[model samples]
Target: MRLNSLVKPLLITGFMLAGTAQAAPDAREVLEASPVDDIVAQYPEMMSRGIQDGLKQSGQVPPMVADSIGFLVSNSFRAADIEQRVVANLEAALTPEQLEEVHGWYQTPVAGKIAEAEIAASAPAAWPEIRSRAEDLNKRYQGTAREKLFDRFDAASRATESAVDTTIAVQLGLGTAMAALSRDSVHHEKMRERLESQRPALRGMVGQQVYDGYLFTYRDISNQEMNLYLDFLESEAGRSFTRVVTNSVQQAVIEPVESIGARLAAFGNFGGE
Candidate 1:
C-alpha cells in the first residue's frame, strides 16, 4: 500500500469520527438551550399567585386559611420537580430526529428573541403592565393583520387550550381545599363533569385573554419574525415540543393539588373554620 493512499484513508476516517461526535443533544442539553426550562421554573410562583388571586376574588376564605392553603400549594409544585418532569417527557415524547430539530430551532436568533419576550411576560412584574395595556392593545390590533397572525400562532401553539387546562387545574385545587375545610368529600369526577360543561364559555373567555396577552408580549416582535416562529410551531418538531411541555407542566400543576386538601386539613381546627 502506498503512503499517500494510507494518509487519505486516515483523513477520511477522522472526518467521519468528527461528524459522529456532533450528534443530537440529550434531553437536558436541549432544555438548557431553550426557554422551556426558564418558563417552567416560574410555574410554582405562578401557581401561588393564581391561588392567592382566586382566594382574594372569592372574598370568602379567611386570611389565615387562605395563606395556609397558598403556602401548602406553592410548596408542593417545586420548579425542580417540574423541570425534571418536562425533561423526562421530552425524552419520551420526541424521537431523536425531532429532538435534534427542536434543539436546533431553539438555538436560533429568532427563537432566542421570542423566548425573551415570553420570559418577560411570564414574570410577576409584567402582570400590571400587561393588564394596563390590554384594552389599548385590543382596541389597536383587534382587526389588523398582526391580530390574524397572533390568532394563527395561538392556534398552532394551542395557547388557549393550555390556558383552559391550567385554569381547570387551579379550580380543581381550590375545590379540593374547600372540600377539605368543609370536612366533605371531593368528587373529582363530578367536578370535572361540571367544568367540562362550562368549557365552551371558559374557552371563549380564555381565548380573548390569550389574544390580549400575545398582543402585549409580542408587541415589539416583527411580523416577519413571528411568521418564522409560526412556521416552527406548525412544524413536526414544534408540535412535539408543545405537546411535551404542555403535558408536563399540566401534570406537575395538577398532580400536586390532589393532596392540597389533605395537607390543608392537617391544619386541624384552623382548616375547619
Candidate 2:
C-alpha cells in the first residue's frame, strides 16, 4: 500500500512537471500553426476591396482608374511580405511563454473551427454573401447573448481597429498616388493627421461592419464554442497574439504603400494598361 501511494504521488508530480515543460515556439512555428497564413494570403484582396470602395465613395475616379488602383494595391500588399512582418513583430512582442501559449491555443479544435470560418469570411468570394445577408443576420442575432458575445470578441480581437488602420493605409496610398501624378507635395504627416482626426467616426462605421461579419462567419459555431473562443481571445496570450498579428499586417501593407507613389506614376504613364 505504501509503495502504491508513493507511486501515485510521483506520477502526479511528473505530470505537473510535464505540463510546465511546454517548449516555447518560434515565431515562424507559431504563425504556421495558426490560421495566419491563409488569412494573410487574403489580405491583398481585402485591401484592394477597401481601396475600391474608398475610390467609389470619392465619386470622381473613373471605373478604369479605380480598377488600376485596385490592381496596384492588391499586388503591393503581398502575403509573403506580410508574413515576414508578422514573424518579425511577433518575435519582438511575444515572450517565449506567450508564444508557446498562443501556439497551444491555435492547436485547439475550437481554434481550428474558428479559423475555418475566419478564412472563409476573409475570402473575396464570401463578401457578396456576407453583404447580401448583413441586414437579415443583424436582425436574427439582435439583442441575443451571441450578439453581445461577438461585440466582446471583436473588441478583444481588435477587428474594428485593424479595419480602421487598413482604411487609413489605403487612404495614404491614394494620397501618395495623387501627389505623384499632380507633382504636389506628399504631406504624409498632414494626411495621417487628417485620418487620425476621423478615427472616431471610422471606428463607429467599421464596428458595425465588423459585427456583421462576425455574425455571418460564426453563424455555424454554437454559442458554447464562441464562448470558448472568446475566453481564449480575452486571455492575455490571445490578446497579445491578436494585437501583434494585426499591427504587423498593417505595418507591412503601409510600408509598401509608402513607396507606391513612383510605381503608381509609372502605371499612370501607361494609362494603367
Candidate 3:
C-alpha cells in the first residue's frame, strides 16, 4: 500500500475534529490514568525496582506527568499538520472500486483473524524463563548490560514513532489530492453530504480498528523483541551487545525497514516503467 493511503484515515479524522469546541483533555492526566500505568505496573524489572515512571528507567529524574503529556500533545499536533498533505493525495487516488476493497479488507474476518494469530504466534512460550535470564544477566553485568539494551529499545521505539509520523504525513498529502480531484461544486457538495451522512458510523468503525491495530502491533512487536533480548541478557556476550549495540541497530536499521519495504512495494508496482 502507498504510504499516504495507509495514513489517511488516522490523520484526517483527527484534523477534521480539531475544530470542536470541547475542552481538550489533559494529555498528562490521560497518560497517567491510561493503560500506561497498568503496563508499567506489570513490568517485572521496573516495577520491582519501583520505577514506574520511565525517567528512572533511563537513570533520569522523572518529570511531572503533566510535562510529558504536554510534550506528547504538542508533538501529536505538529505531526498531524505534516500528515495532512499525504492524506489528501491518498484520498485523491482512491478509486471508488479501490475504496470498496479497502473497506472490505478492514471489515474482513480474515484480516482480524490473521492479525490475532500472528500476535499469538509472536508471544514467547516461557516468559518466566526469559525474565529469569534477564535478571541473572543484570546481576552478572551489574545492570550495565540491561541498561544498554533498554537504551537500544528506546531508540527503536522512537524510530517507529517517526515512521508512523512520516506515513501519516504522506497520507495527508494524498487527502489534499483527493479534495482537488473531486468534480464540480455539486459533486464536492455531494461527497461532503455523503461523508456527513456516514460520519458517525465511519468514525466509530475506523477509530476502533485503528486503536485495536495499534495496540496489537505494539504488544506483538514488543513481546517478540523482548524474548530475544531476554535471551541475550542471560548470556554474557549478549548482555554486552545489548548494552552497546541493540538500541542503536533497532533505531538505525530495523525501524526504517518498514518504510523501505513500503517504498519497494511502490516501485515494484510501477515495474521500472
Candidate 4:
C-alpha cells in the first residue's frame, strides 16, 4: 500500500472488550458481509497518483516507463489478496455474534453513507482541504460536550494504531522493501536502526495525516450522528469487533511485504540474458 497505511485504523478495540462467543463465522463470510471492501477498494487509484508524483519528484525515470511502473505497482500492491486475509483473521479473533453486529452496522443506511464519505475523504486529493477543515472543527467544537466525546474516540483510535507505531511500521516496511533489493547492504538490524533515527519526523507527519483524515471522514455527518456512531463503537460487541478488525488489517498490511520485496529484489533474474 505504499507508505500510506490505507486503512484509517479508527476506534480500535480488541476482543478483550467483547463478550464470549456465539459461534464464530468463517472469515470469508465475515469479510463478504463487512464494509471493509468498500473502505479499501478506493486505495489503488489514490496510491497510483501518489506513486506517479513521487516518481516524477525523483526525476529518474522516463515518463512512459514511470507511468507503466506506477500502473503495475498500484495493481500489484492492491491485488495482493489482502482483504481476504484480513477478514479471515478478524473471524478467527472475534465471536460470530460480534461479527454479526459489526456487519449489521456496515449495512445500515447511515453507515453506508459514512463509508462513502470516508472512501472519498481518504483520497490524497482530500488531504489539503481535510487539514484545513480539521482546524475549524477543533476550534468550532472547543469546550463543548461533543468535543469531549470526539476526543475519546480520537484517543482510542490513536491508542489502537498510534502515529508512532504507524511511522515505525511504515519506515520498516519501506526499509525492508529496499533491503529485498539490496542483498548485501540492507540487513534487517541496520535498517531498523536507520528507521529509528527517522522516527521523530515520521511521527509528526503521521499525526497530521491522521488528524486530517478523522475530520474528513466525519465532515458531512452531524455531531448527533457521530455520537450515535461512537455509542455503537463503545459497546461490548463494537469494541470486540474493532479490536479484531484493527489487528486483521494490520496483519494484512504486512503479509505481502517480504514476498513482494523479494520479487522486486530479483529483477536481475528477468533480464540476465
Q: List the residue pairs that clash in candidate 2.
A: none
* Tens digit per residue, CA lDDT, model 3, 115-149: 34433422333333434454444454454433344
Model 2 gets an lDDT of 0.84
**What TM-score goes with each of the models?**
0.88, 0.82, 0.22, 0.68
Off by over 4 Å in 2: 1-22, 179-190, 262-273
Q: Which residue ranges in model 3 land beyond 4 Å of their true spot?
A: 1-56, 65-89, 114-273
How do all the candidates rank in terms of TM-score, highest first? 1, 2, 4, 3
- The predictions' CA RMSDs to the true structure, in order, are 3.1, 6.0, 25.6, 13.5
Clashes of 4: 2
| Tens-digit per-residue lDDT, 128-167, candidate 2 | 9999999999999889998889768878988887888887
Instruction: Predict model 3's lDDT versus the native.
Output: 0.36
Q: State the lDDT of candidate 4 residue by residue for 1-273, as single tens digits.
A: 644453333212334335334444455655665556655565466545655665576564557755764575566556236676676667567776777777777668877777678667766777668767887877766686655665667655443245466446644654464444434466767878887887777766766566556665776787777777787778777777666666655555444444444455566334433
lDDT scores of the candidates, listed in order: 0.83, 0.84, 0.36, 0.61
lDDT of 4 at 73: 50
Cα distance off (Å), candidate 1, residue 7: 7.4
The alpha-carbon lDDT assigned to residue 105 of candidate 4 equals: 76
Q: On residues 22-99, what C-alpha lDDT tens digit does candidate 1 reach at each position?
A: 887888988888887888878777777778777878875877767777787778888888889888989998998989
Best by TM-score: 1
